[model samples]
Target: MFAENKLTEDFGDIRNFLLSEREKTLSEAEWRFRMRGYGYNLKRVDTGYEVARMTTQQVIGTLDL
Candidate 1:
């Protein structure tokens, strides 16, 4: 397991990087806008990227159900 302090430090580093790359990074709203073109509703998953919702049926089908 990762230590809490280490995790905090890592998150701070990532935040700094994002701040430095703000102009290049896609905001949550922008990502959702792009995903809407593909008929997907995307939301920010974490401090990093966006994610789209998936159904249980899709997961099961993908698993060869």
Candidate 2:
């Protein structure tokens, strides 16, 4: 659920934000399970959660984009 034409730089910042907040925002197990659903296995180190990239496509063909 991101806006169109949002720069890759902006996305990178968002990922950084999530990674920085994982522990403060979610329990370790909760964060791990959530990330694992998207195929990211997180390890608890000095950082909260490592960011993983997933390429998702918009289904605009049926929405008349």
- Number of backbone-clashing residue pairs for each candidate, in the order shown: 0, 0
lDDT of 1 by residue, 1-65 (tens): 01222333243443343334444547746644644443334344344443232332121111110
Q: Which predicted model would earn the best TM-score?
A: 2
Q: Lowest-scoring 10 consecutive residues by lDDT in candidate 1? A: 56-65
lDDT of each: 0.35, 0.44
The runs of at least 3 residues in candidate 1 whose Cα sits more than 4 Å from the true structure, single-residue gaps closed, are 1-25, 44-65
What's model 2's lDDT at 44? 47
For candidate 1, the clash count comes to 0
lDDT of 1: 0.35
lDDT, candidate 2, 7-49, per-residue tens: 4435455455345545455576876576555434454445343
Candidate 2's TM-score:
0.37
Give the deviation of candidate 2 from the true structure as CA RMSD. Answer: 11.7
